[model samples]
Target: MSPDLPCIVFVRSFLHKPDNIDHTEHHVRQETPKQIDGHTHRRKHSSDSEKTLTVEDWATSRENPHNWPLAKRVITSLVVYIYTFVVYSGSSMFITAVPLVMQELHLSEQRAMLGLSIYVLGYGVGPLLWGPLSEIPRIGRSVVYFGTFVAFILVTIGAADVSNYSAFIFLRFMQGLFGSPCLANGGASMHDLYPESQFPYTLALWVAAAYCGPALGPLLTNSLVNNISWKWTMWLLACMSGPVCILLFLLPETYAPTIRYRSNAFNTSHNQNNNNTSSQDDNPLAKLKFYLVKPVQITLQDPAILFANIYTSFIYGTYYTFFDAFPIGYPPVYNVSTTTLSLFYLSVLVGCLLAVAAYFTYLSLPNYLRKHHDNTSPKSTPTHTPPTKHERHLIPAIPATFLVPISLFLYGWTLRPSIHWIVSIIGVTMYASAVFIILQCLSMYIPSIYPEYAASLFAANDFCRSTLAAGAVHFGIPLYKNLGMARGSSVLGGVSGLGVLGLLGIYYFGERLRAKSRFVERLVE
Candidate 1:
């Protein structure tokens, strides 16, 4: 009942178990309506309870999200990976074939880009619903994700079947709306499958999966279009969603709190059987309904919650918008085709790998600091410095804060239509490295600060970033045509340089800002 009880309840829940807990026995549950995170809740050994309770298997654990017995966690990750591929294929896969769509629909270049825009719009809005929906029991995340994606497939079919251009865009928007959950919920799945210590690395691999879809999207869709037709792109994606839907039934519920609540129910009921109570109670059904109906409210309604999310969104989303400028701003100026363009995306993958190195490099900091402290300590006693945010697990997005613009300037000026594609590729490689670093930072930062609502917080950010990226795509081509490629790219480069500066200012001021935020301050304390 005390204000601090949520934290206490959550900690106790993680460190201990419900075998040692019961509905009639819990002081906290009686007074506080909120349940602790199930993942954090550990079932302790006790004479009364025989249930071998663990949210995840102890052997594979976080060491390998990929290493799960192919049947359980790995299958879930792969199926979710398939969902990601479908969602992104709806975006980038349509890109090369935009001319085909425009020809059929009688739309202009800018207008045809709307399909891609609509898909991204889904990426923005889907999270608000999906993230909260995933946390609720009975109606677990996998169900919500599978159900919405099936709906998305229907919407995709509608887009394919539409005769009217206006109706087409509208249907595409609905597709995006349903598809957004994959990205928002996918991150949560990655976390559920991995541990905090392995989170950064596993996250890097997951990030690659999400982006890999975009990179590989064109290849797969191009082959599809080459053989069949562009209209079939959506059709193929819809077809793929079917198998993924089937896979969801086998996907174990990874939401920790929900897992714990169910385990408790199983135990309490079985124990009741042992006690020889012969009764059929309506209350269990009522509780099941209660669990199903519970909602997580994280709307932009609360001023404090809104500002924290929005502020984080802007700082993070700006990078996404900044990177979207890459393809049109520099590639064509260097005379790269859509087919060759996929080569450039490899940089993001490379950056993701580097980010793993950077993260482990960071994980070593505590050890390094401890050693330094030991050497410098007084003989009789030891005094140590509290790890600052900068020095602690938050590693500087290495080589990126500088690499982005340098890559930009190199590609911008040197990239003439006549120049070899390699020059621009090299430039893009740097920019990709920087962008991937930014992506890594944003991904890790969201979860690090708001571990409970990691999906929602990132969902809030996806809207900001996706919206800005869509807006930039709308205006970028026109700006470049009017202003000329070199100058246009120069202007963009200058703005991006400013973004890097913003990153610096944010990194320096970021800790202070979070320290001041009542939500985060409360969490950290």
Candidate 2:
């Protein structure tokens, strides 16, 4: 719906009492302009206003996407998924371009890979803003999504054109800066659109779509860079944004409170009626402390609280560092073309698909337990035993730990120009798959345990992960070169393997561990 169109403007006015408010179709913009390269063209925005929607609001409101007509909810999920796909694509789109970047910029292989690192830097930092900033009911979601996109597309062009290394890295960071809101909020938006029962599975689908960008980006860019210059790869990637904005223009505001507040306000003013407090008398937000949560406070305080979770930070930071580490070590070891390099992107896909399948399996266990047992309330079922130290989800990180080093060692040691590329690919696949499972576990577990501040928690985690990835990309090549791929990978693999010990410890003692953190404990029960 065009912001100026009657339907778009009418929906923004109160649905129940449109006559009371101004009915004219006006495009009321929000904190951020909503448009980016993939899904929108946006202008910069600034604000921190948002309505607090509790878990109860999620269940009872027919306006919530979970309660909306099935078709409407599906469309909403797809809309979010599309934006994630594009933002992720932008990150890895330069995978095959490292060589071109090296030659064009008069840099070494080590420095050239910084092009990729610079983008990851963006992802790390973006969530701090995008997650909290989009909370406003008044600013509207479309404006937020679209506005950021416009800034993102422009920055991509700038990054491509910048001649100086410092300048190019700066623009790439800006691209990430603008593009990150889509990744950060898209998950929360999905939560808004679906119930907790369906959140894991639906989120799995969204993650899989997000994973597609890393897989497809390298493959697509490899082809583009092979036929032409790396510039075409970015140009083509940015150009794909045109249609996404067209679709976003029609997308409705799915955030329920925004819709409800507008509707109620319209009714109160239109017929000279009473406020929600006077009319409905059952407004949940009446008691909410709305004014104190300024944007700056949210940005600083929320992240500080989340950063206190060492496990979330360590895991996210470690995962992305090693993820990019794979490209740095294996790409040069095998001497493959940009196109062939994309084949290395499969490790995460294999692991991700398994994780996705595992997500459904986890969902099925509860259902199966319900069927076999005499169940009354959904919460009272006793078919399953409580999780034990050994029976933990985080345990998967153990095997993944070994794969990280072992695969890299194998790829590094075996990857001579004379060796077939398949051996190296096997190593990459193993590492990607391992990383994928851990990544999924970290994201899902945090939310599962701390549903209240899941969005903020994710942002804090991204801050750690992105910062580490940026560092790893810059430092990884040197380590691999000095130690050689086998030894370098072995060392990294060992550290990552050591990380597994932490996961195992958590799996075994997580309950006791959760008992230690007030934030975790308070949020859970």
Candidate 3:
């Protein structure tokens, strides 16, 4: 019952700590301090009844995710990856079925495309709700992941059965809404299991799965769509998601606060006492409001984050635009069936794999080795000065930025029937690699600038990108139709070139902008 008990100290530390403080750095004394003769002294060999638990004890305990054996960690991370992949696949699986739906439902291409766009929009909105709910200790992450996915399965089933277009669109939106937690929180789950030093490696793998999911969607369901009813796409989603839902039950809660609160060391009386002393902001409704409002506020106020969101959003939109753009470019020129065209997406997957390798080789490996050397070397040993935190993230991104415009131009011009399809595939591959690098770099760099608001900023980033991509799905078809493939892609490439200038400006002036931010100023104070 004592406030000074080690378990109580750990609880209080977690409750009041900033959002981004590294969990691995937390340490608590193993012994209780006693006041004796007007001096504080450590009590040695305290009785079992008098002993208390500490963060240090928990850190080493089997319950700690960081202490989980390598196999358990890998399995857990893979489950999360599959869960994320399934959700993202749901967004694009319906793309191949668009023609069938358009013909059967008596709809325009734009109206049919709404099914996909609305789903993207749904996930964009869903994160504002899910991200905050998952942060609460009582709610935890596993509950959100499992519960939302069950809802996703039901919605997918409903979408498969619905004959009416309106009902179909609504169901698709629900699928995205229900399937969204993994997209936003999956990386957070990985962060719970891995130390900061190993996070980038795990993150790269997760991102690859995420990018590949949408790229593979058409390929996975192409035969189904071609051989059977278009409804098979939704059925395929249901089949894939149902088993993953069951597997999710095996995923233990990874959020530290939730695990700590559930432990025997956290007594009910202590919890009640802490709740009694908590501020109004600790209440559920206030917490929800803070989560919803804070992200928007931060996005608008921070110049670096605001522009980063714009640049990334445009890049994200461009990626989705290809879903529509590809059909236009490949079919007329190559005279291929839907199945063969779907095979072109393999190039995107190839690009994703290459990007992950490039990231680890050029960025992750060198930095890790440098850190390892610094830690092991003699104090007097000379070592090269390492890149600053922001610099490390920005370095690869600069070259990747240039690749985007160049890839776009190549892909645009190379779509001619005279040019071999492989040439255009190479361009798409280059664009995918560049996109992966830029997104991964900015994802890390922006959060580093304001760790306190990292979660909110991520939600903001997701919202921006998803909304733009939804629009891009609709815009891409018309742009290609009116301006023709070569001209349309050139327009996009020109815009991306402008984005390069914007990104370069951020690289140079981001620190100065951060210094001027009210949010950054408050954090410093």
Best-fitting candidate, measured by lDDT?
A: 3
The list of candidate 3 runs beyond 4 A from truth reads 1-55, 266-273, 277-282, 367-388, 521-525
Best by TM-score: 3
| C-alpha lDDT (0 to 100) for residue 487 of candidate 3 | 93
lDDT of 2 at 55: 31
Query: Candidate 1's residue-wise lDDT over 329-360, tens digit each?
Result: 55556555555665565554565556556655
Q: How close is candidate 3 to the true structure, as a TM-score?
A: 0.86
Q: TM-score for all predictions? A: 0.72, 0.72, 0.86
* Candidate achieving higher lDDT, 2 or 3: 3
By TM-score, the better pick of 2 and 3 is 3
Clashing pairs in 3: none
Candidate with better lDDT, 1 vs 3: 3
Error of 3 at 72 (Å): 1.0
Would you list the C-alpha lDDT of every candidate in the order shown? 0.55, 0.57, 0.76
* Backbone clash count, each prediction separately: 4, 26, 0
> Once superposed on the true structure, which residue ranges of model 2 sit more than 4 Å away at CA?
1-62, 161-165, 265-335, 366-420, 523-525
